[model samples]
Target: MSERPHMSSTSWRRSQPITSGFGAGWVLVIFGVLAFLLPPGGTAQQPPDPVPPVGVAPAAVEAENDQELQTIFRSEISFVRVDAIVTDEDGNALVDLTADDFEIFEDDIPQKIESFKLVKHTGVFDPDLPPPGTIRNEFDLEREAAREDSRIFVFFLDEYHVRDYNAMRMMQPLVDFVETQLAPTDLVGIMYPLTPLFDVTLTRNHEQIVHALRQFKGRKYEYDVLNGYEAAYAHYPTTDVEKIRNDVSLSALKALAMKLGGLREGRKSIIVLSEGYTDYVPPQLRDESAGGGGRRGAMRYNPLAGNSRMEESTRLFQDMGMRANLVYTADIANRNNTSFYMVDPRGLAVWEYDMSQVPIDHETDQSMLRILQDTLYVLADESDGRAIVNRNDIGPGLAQIVADQSSYYLLGYTSSEAPTDGEFHEIKVEVNRPDVRIRARKGYYALTEDNATRLMAPPKPEPPSAVSRALAKLAEPTRSRLVRTWVGASRGDNGKTRLTFVWEPIASGQSRRDESASQVMLMAMSDNAAYFRGEVPSRPGGTLPLAEFEADPGELELNVAIEDEYGDVLDRAVDELVVPDFTGTDVALSTPTVLRAQNTMEMRRIAADPDALPTAGRYFRRTDQLLLRGEAYAPGASPVDVTARLLNREGASMMPLPVELSAGGAYELSVQLSPFPRGDYLVEVSAASGDGVATTLVAFRIQG
Candidate 1:
């Protein structure tokens, strides 16, 4: 692909927060995803495979649960939405179809049409929404995206396959299409094969998107050096490098289709600009040591005398790879209701190779061209889209894509057989009216047995009422939280509770100019009276001296004001707290504080120190260990032993971790970092004394 330009702005910082709305104790976890499955009528069932053993780590099981949850959620909606564009003999959209005029089926089983609606746009933007050119942030973009009438478009520029000359020629047509063919309310995004799906946001700023297209440059075969990823394999042979490039582009495209599918159950258009895909490189260009010049160097002397045996062997290998990639790509797009309109920019070309570089036979050149072009046709035809190939004027084809998006009939129905065997189910849509054609998705995937069971299972027991309320408060959304704050509680003097508040900035490459979270102003009060007020840290990016205050046992209200370097309040929040007196109880334990350490030596230092501060951030890397300590008290200085264990998000036990006594007689637990994978886990610690037990759960996420 062409190298991405360094466009400096807050665009990178405008990433949406990852939120998972599970129950109170469950947190959203991200990890490696499974491979994309092919759609129906394209591939046969492999056979009934045995259920995999459940002995894998919790991370794998959690991933399975997440996938199953998504599947079940889709199925439980009880409605399959199909977008159909009916065109008459003249190639104009026929959008006046009623619900009774459509028939839906799954695996040849007819289903009842529950709902139907006609979606039409007259090339006019909505009056209530903001203008197309006024987008400033991601929030503004999302507001426009939520509109039901808005159209979505993603321009996938496949520079890896396009020649530099072809890229330049195609830019004008694309820009013209955007400027003249699309409506102002349409939300468009620009993406490359290497662009992460999270970073691609739909926006109304058409001018900026067009400006980015003007700098398009293709890096087809001249891979010298551009980025770090490409540099790592620059010395590899050209044949191997070509195969890797194909896989990278296809994977990113599959992810993009899935992202669009999840946005809504409507039709989405992705315009792919490229030459085509080829598994086999011509023998004249294949070199074992590509940059070193082995066979290719000899080909310079006698280009027509290439080895047939070696060429045939390499061709077979490439065909297998290409077929597998094609299945996955088509399956993902069909299942997600996204169409891929492929544009081949090598227009009116006569030869695949330069005559001066490689003097190849005419038969070989024709064969190679046929195989490459076939890949493009298969992608477009299988996804219910048209392939604009073998033509010089792409204006008409580009305009047709927008027209298809403008008017369509949306038909929804409940599937008769709700299968949960994790297999592909075919879908067919037909119109009762005559002399008209129809286009729609071919199939959808069903959930697995395990996922369906969990989705139908009863809800887990709820947490204590007080703990439940506190956890619910964490679900509220915060706008660009530059800093994360935490409050700690322990025993204090004079039969009162000790409160310690800490705040730290979040480091995610999303900082603004001249803005830093200096300190926070803290205030504590009751319903009718105030307890204490103070300021922390006194400077930006500096740690505050741990201030401890005593408060009587009751419901205490906390009002916190977060300030910047100029002592200006950036955000303010109010919190409710319940304090308990430890002196009057027979056995008590403070809220366990977790302190993170990067290495074993740091862990030891933190465990031995009497005043190590707890980290406010909940995110931790796997390369870091953790030291958790808390004070357990008993009447008359009797002994109070504490034990700790790890639990999954479902509140089931995973393993028991060792708890030991630190230097100051504080109960400490050593959490090993290597055994855990990337997911949310809870550390349950319980204190045991004479006829008393107190337990607390500390939740945190480990970066994969």
Candidate 2:
């Protein structure tokens, strides 16, 4: 593996002032001197704009500048935007307050308000206005999410912390909230603790959200392993499992806040429905291990026995960590102008545990109950949202969640201190009018200098031309209606290129066709003559059907007909491809093939066998290992230098992959998917020779 070269000095110098130790006042002074040096009557040159503050859009920056810049001297300045909700004693929003009525302060120092706007959204669609469109993709999500009349809400259902009975009781309220509280124009999404943020879709389809909530069942205190992720840790101690559940839930909440932050700068709300979070399980219900077996019989319920000095210390440390996580999550939410509305499903609950499961002392039960409810209060209060706890009727509380998001005052200010300490800074928003209650986020975490610099840095270099072209194939529209296909071209005999065509039936549920595709009729032809035409039967044991043919290095046409078991055509597709001239004198690379192996044994077998068939499917599991094999060619007998590297979807190189030259003169790279998270990635293979250089990219996706 080789290290990427350092950024140029010019690039570093360009971003120096942003993270410089000098304050904004000094920056203004330097810019003034430069303006004086300019010719008379000339426009004062502006410095390159600093990276806009997180969650603040470029349009917002331009608007702020138009109102804030009254002098001839202007420097690159960043503004921290805050969303404040002011309501009178009767809970009516104060929408008519002007900029003069509000005073903002950061770290106890008064700051000038740079931008102010009253954001009032009813979340209702006007009858005269066109209806909102359904959110089918990222583009639609962004466009709909940015509308001022629309509000974004995501329900974070913490199934691990709520009881099954309570979850059932609350489902109707959640459904009703969607039906009556939310308008047709509002976009809503729901997420479980294990749900990926990418998988959570915000849409105008209210029925989909309700349908998902109806199936919400809690598994708190139940150790049955449901998924592969839980199976690995099902045998851990009961206390450890509780901690793990808390960690997962909190992490998910934090990620959801960040995700909402990316969608838009406006106030986003996440409704958390759970009993609450606790890092420690009571000794009365503590099992030696979660997996019930002989271990359960060995440990009897002894409430006082487990609370030793060491155990108490451990409990304290765990509680501290959990609290820190909650604070950090709140900070992120505040920075993103998002709020968390914590709803306790166990409304007016008396005991935290049931005696039927395990005997517990009254004192211990009450203490644990308070601790659980306190967690909810901390999360909600810190994020400037309401917490509905210990209440039998939560209808009004739930409605208030909507009311809070309905209207707010969006205020932006340039912190005179301009702290870059990467620490939480308190924000105080005061309205001059009396008899009104003010609610806003307590504070936000300032970006560190390094983070600011990185955000302001220039974008990375684009991928090579050949690699770009190869990646474009991944986006090619599939013409076949019943099956997916992969086509590759490599060096063939003489001056021709070897074309490999592989096909497999689309996943059973993904295809609209009733009949499964059993084979494909492949036809290869050039402008003047047909190259090859035959039927490729589908393999029975999960192997992909492949057809090989030789064609001249030029434009070629492919005709494919998908047939069922009875030989009746189910679908047809025609594609035009440009076969690369692999026999050229310049440095060249053949189409790369990706093969998957389930385990070490399978991986070794594939590595030893150079002729192993490649998988046509682009999707793979996180537990799988991938082998990328390709060939590099050069003019005459000159040896070609081949290298492999992993790249993100944006073409930024993540890391270099070591390439091995096999005995058959082929280049191979083994990538372990376990090290990579679930996302789309690319493998870049580059070959350089005395004559020239060439590169190609292979794109694949990993699934959890």
Candidate 3:
């Protein structure tokens, strides 16, 4: 193993000194020493020991026959896997060591190593092998991520804890790291504090990652609401808002770790770009409201104001709560074999607060700076990872991160104690080679008896057929196409089917924007004859390009040519659709049309207009209401009963939706979205006439 000379911290200091009151060089020197002391491979100083676990209460044992059956269901041996990185004094990985050169222990008892292998990955694919495929869905992501040669990395950009200027300075380094340091096979993802874990997908498209990073803007002390989530708490006190931010970030971190754990048991990395976290805001900067201007008059600068007994107690409690949350987050990361590489974007930061923005004494500023940096250190150290702090040049630290994940040893063994008490067990790894440091997970928590039993339980039952079909509708359309289209069939005159074709241009952000879709040349043909052939010009706003024609009920083939503004075709597609037979004697319902409105007035207008255009979009904001319109028909004027109900993604009924008969004779179902959370839901509409019954489902997504 060879070490990169750029990994040295000695030359990371800035040439010029900070103009802040404190001596910036002195603070940098302290942090630099701290960084070198850990040396990336191992932590010389361990965090405070966690509290001992309490013993589980005794429980009655099962019958001998049942115990034997359970034993057959569960694994006879409890295996523990540990990933260790052995590096020499110069921080170069030692890959030559074998199982004979290493020893392992659990809870101070020596255990025999049952499995050992060197897992080395350069993040570069072999030229001899074909290039990997793009990750388009969850299946692709999971398959690619499971490859041993592919390294998974996630960038958790905590914008709430970083200043805008600092974030700008750090963006180039991040982009460079992704563009130059990473190979084409590496899987990378970028996430914000509020981004849902399901929304994150790791891909090899480095350009997309770079584009997202370029748009990064931090908001450390600023409290303007940018989205619906922030709007909920944007008016709170500054201190409370800070606490909320801290909670949100920590929770996101834990969730990411868990998500990676589910993906694979191999080592994964989450690089957190943040200044640091603090639950308590300094007195000088705290305002009555987060978005309000500074308090009236010159701010009081009392460095010792928080030193009183009451204030000190309050600070102590807040610190305790923050520490507890950090411990929980670290524990989750470790359990998932995920490492957190903390990077303070405010490289060589000298002051916690900008004097120009807020009036603060030097002492308070210095103290707050230390507290924030301490948090970064605690998180990194607890997770057996390194913290890059107080360094002007972060390129070396970033390189070291790649080096750490490039090569390592994976070892597994069955625990000698085989305890199922649901307690944390300490692990120790040692290498016989001289001058080599071994860094591995400190330990892992054992599963309780009940947990073990549940793990061995039978697989879950499959979802209902109706639920499965509804959820399947949530699958996204292929984004490589030029436009998104919708087709519907309803009852037509003279015992024929009325086929409606609607199309809209896909957003430029979602697809290639080289050419805008102007119109669609549509040709609908049945087995016997051509029903329609014409051009549908695109319209703006709520109205879209729509074409309707009467066709015989059967398989209809559609050839659509998407054209540009100049009438030149940009793309073409062929679709085979089954036109429903609404002219039959059985009870039947027409394909539902979804119309979105911002308020009741808009909804009423849509209901009144029989020919109002239906939206092709399936995504709606929480404030938007959807009106579903369709026609229910029965033979010989026999009255047809129509009803509607809301179902969750899993197919369970959430609530009953009333179906109203409009004066125009159209059955309409109005859905208010504000009461629902952000997710995919289904609206099931059914029509019944005597023994004949027909049903249809409409699925849509709610966005925050």
TM-score of 1: 0.73
TM-score between candidate 2 and the true structure: 0.76
TM-score of each: 0.73, 0.76, 0.71
Score candidate 3 by TM-score against the native.
Answer: 0.71
The total number of steric clashes, by the backbone 3 Å criterion, in model 1 comes to 0
Q: Least accurate stretch of 10 residues (summed lDDT) in model 1?
A: 1-10
Summarize candidate 1's per-residue lDDT along 336-375 as a digit string, tens digits.
6778898988876566665435677666677667767778
Give lDDT tens digits, candidate 2, residues 1-704: 21111001011111112111213233333433322222112233445566778899999997776445432232122357788899999999989999999998888889898789898886667566556777776667767787878898999999998889999999999899999999887889999999965566798889999999999999889889898889888988888888899889988887777667766778889999988777876665567778666266233567554446765665567667777888887876776678899999998989988755766566667767887888898899998888999988888999998898889998887677666677888889999999999998787776677754553444587766544544444442222246767777778999988888877777766544467888999898988879999999998888778988899977777877778899997767666767777675677777778889999999999888877888776778899999998888778878778888999877788999999975334798989999888877888888887747777778777868
RMSD of each: 10.4, 11.3, 14.2
In candidate 1, stretches whose alpha carbon ends up further than 4 angstroms from where it belongs are 1-82, 96-116, 125-148, 222-240, 282-309, 352-366, 412-435, 441-486, 501-587, 634-639, 661-665, 688-692
Query: Where is model 2 more than 4 Å wrong at Cα?
Result: 1-78, 126-131, 297-299, 303-316, 468-485, 490-497, 503-517, 525-530, 539-544, 561-574, 581-704
How big is the positional error of residue 201 in model 2, measured in Å on the Cα after superposition?
A: 1.1
C-alpha lDDT of residue 377 in model 3:
85
| Predicted structure 3: clash tally | 0
Query: Tens-digit lDDT track for model 3 on 1-704?
Result: 11011000011111222111222223333433322211111122223434334563223222443455555434332567788999999988998989999899999899899789898887678666656877876667767878877888899999999899999999999999999899887889999999966677898889999999999999988888899889988778788889899999998898777667656767889999999887866665566778775452223365555445665466567777877778668767876678899999989999987855655656656767887898898788777788999998999998888888888898887777777787878999998878888889888667677766665565577766756655554444444456667787788889898877888887876664467889999998977999999999888764777998999877778887888999998877777766778777877777788889988899889878878888777888899999998888778778778888998877778999999975323698899999999998988888787887777778788977
